[model samples]
Target: MKLKNNHIATFLLSFLLTFLCAIPSIAQTPNSTYTIEQGDWLSKISKKAYDSPHLYYRIIEGTNEKATSDASFLKINSANDIRIGQKIWIPGLPSPKNLTHVPKTDCEIRLWYNYQIVAVGVINEKWMQDGIDLETRAHKAYDLRHKARVNARFMMQDKEAVKTLQARDIKKYGNPDGPTFTYLLNKSMEGGQSQEVAYQTIIDSSSKTDTRYNADCQ
Candidate 1:
């Protein structure tokens, strides 16, 4: 059957419009979603995906609007808010490149304690290769840790120093454990001493009144 010229023009025009409209949907990048595992937190997601915990807000911002305005805004504990196979949007996050993920190298780590510069350390290639970077906020934390350890040691050797730290701890962080740094150091040397675990023990012991001072009597 012979088609009218006007009808053929309309058909071709319609086809062109349809193809143009499909470009955006076709070009859209497929989003990858992560299930909330036990111990998962916004900070952890930000760290794993964006390499910075400060980017947690970005993840919140990237969620679908329907998810945002509802009860799931900050309800991180709810499984329905985040579950297996849920299509979450991870916006502006770069895809992994190569067999080994190479973290960005151009970053610096500096630490300040009580508004004074305490220590500064470079984020070396080794740390970056191991997926550790200045973005992790580890260098400043580790610097403070070293400073705390040195101060703790000085306090252990000198009675006056111990009193000074105790006073400072009470004024700033409140209540010092009776067993003190001298005892903690001894315990720390006995094989395993993960800094996090050790710090937790110190905090727990300091908070508890039942724990005796110098239980070892050394």
Candidate 2:
């Protein structure tokens, strides 16, 4: 086991991210096959499949679940834990129709949504490259999260604000551990309210937090 220095760095960063898991909370549906070559990593494999590297955890979950029944997949414990020449499963879970797993009440949504903004804000910073101080990364994200404007924007989500969405029947995310923030931009033709819209609203609301986290949370 000789792993590149970058892989070790990825491991350290991954350890830090474990503080607040941004793992996709959606259910797992392992259906694709991606041959692992040298230099393959979970984030890279996830980017290839989902067009976003942040969702790598989904592949890890999907592959591991598939392995329990088939014994042909690798049980990944970290973002970079994969072997070359091993045929890893490319995870693809069914899209959620509503928030069955997510707390339905506005207050519950508030608690979960607020928690998600901070957790994701810290994760999506992607401040793991060499020469970047981990302390600085942590401090910056913390500071921006409490900034007056950021806090104000976060405060906007209330029971009254999301009244209509609460009435709609949101689909369950299947996986209890997956992240609730589905970055999907799909919309339904049913009318002014939709499952995708409702979930996206929660995700989009965190944009301000994410922007500052990424830009200033260095």
Candidate 3:
């Protein structure tokens, strides 16, 4: 029933309310428990904890299961739902992503959400962030895509940084198709951290289209 509380259809704006204050910092590393830090992501945590980033879903399972017993541990609805200052549990034993064992539609939604996060991660890197908000950034990203729906281009100040990442993905994944991009993203730390006030505090703005791309997700 806890999982149903997060279903998009029943989603409420109240979830957007700010937490009064950040909880006191929790222990890091000694035992698998971690306080989500800026730039911290499940995959990155997995890499440090399990030696493989691909096993991030294990954290999702571990954290969510922990939620059932401890209200302090919030359930991570999706890969992109983690917020700064929250507590996360890194499972000591291997286990599948329990959350992913859902209907086919949910699986696809998860994939789409993951893509949005990756796109946001790319933009947030060394691009233009002169104190602009997420909504504005989302709009700008949408504008770039709209301007050139095919082969859109917005030069970054640090071309080499993005270029380096791009080059690495090209060599590791070959070309840049959906499957290949997904594979590369899963191994990245770009979308692992958040600079916002709360988790998913605003509109989803990392897609090639509008930030709220409900195209196939709905």
Candidate 4:
């Protein structure tokens, strides 16, 4: 009798452990679909589902496979090309709590924001030179620009500080040569005043020698 009781207890414990281990996988099943709506770009959808807009590539890869094939589908060429009313498959994503948000100062935020704008402008000019359609180029530009802004926002924890900097940028620059935030931040960082001043100074000095920014790629 004693031996039988011991055997039963061991069996129950093993079953309990196995069930507990299976819970997480069951919870993470990704057999879900999302219908695209107005202003619903792949990056935005990825951000909402996975906490980072950069992860849209995962959705494209997962859904483009034969497993999720359906008649009513929109081909996803780039993150910028999803149309309204299209249905997309949602892949299993890790928990949002696992993601990291890097903190940045107001000055750093402005600099990064401007850098992205200029980078997007450069890409846009290239696309024009390549003779890509206006609509496709516009979509790609919007996606790239939006991703840059979203990334800058993610790096900073202070929302109020960002707002203040944006307002200051608009009031001061009011349509400057580069993006408003970039120009203002560059000016602020000039003369080695801030920590980033050294890096910005190097970039500024090199601009005189490098014609990449001035090249008439278009």
lDDT of each residue in 31-74, candidate 2, tens digit only: 67665766767776766676656556557666666677786776
Candidate number with the higher TM-score (3 or 4): 3
Which residue ranges in model 2 land beyond 4 Å of their true spot?
1-30, 93-133, 139-218
List TM-score per model, in order: 0.23, 0.38, 0.32, 0.30
Model 4 lDDT tens row, 1-218: 99999999999999999998666321212556777766677766766776655456556655564234666655576566677666777676423331233326544454445445545544655777999865465446545555665577667788775576567655766631224334534665665577355333322222111122112210
lDDT of 3 by residue, 1-218 (tens): 77887685345544443332444444344247888888888768777786655456557767787888999999988777899988888766312353354323433434433443434544554344567665465445544433332222122234464466456655866643112323323433256645342122222323323213322332
Q: Candidate 3 local accuracy as lDDT? A: 0.51
Off by over 4 Å in 4: 1-30, 66-68, 94-218
Clashing pairs in 4: none
TM-score-superior candidate, 2 or 4: 2
lDDT of each: 0.42, 0.49, 0.51, 0.54
Best-to-worst order by TM-score is: 2, 3, 4, 1
Candidate 2 global CA lDDT score: 0.49
lDDT (10s digit) by residue, model 1, range 169-216: 667544452234545544754658775565444432322111022112
lDDT preference between candidates 1 and 4, better one: 4
Q: How far out, in Å, is residue 73 in model 2?
A: 1.3
Which ten contiguous residues of candidate 3 have the minimum total lDDT?
A: 197-206
Clash pairs, candidate 1, are none
Cα miss at 73, model 4 (Å)? Answer: 2.5
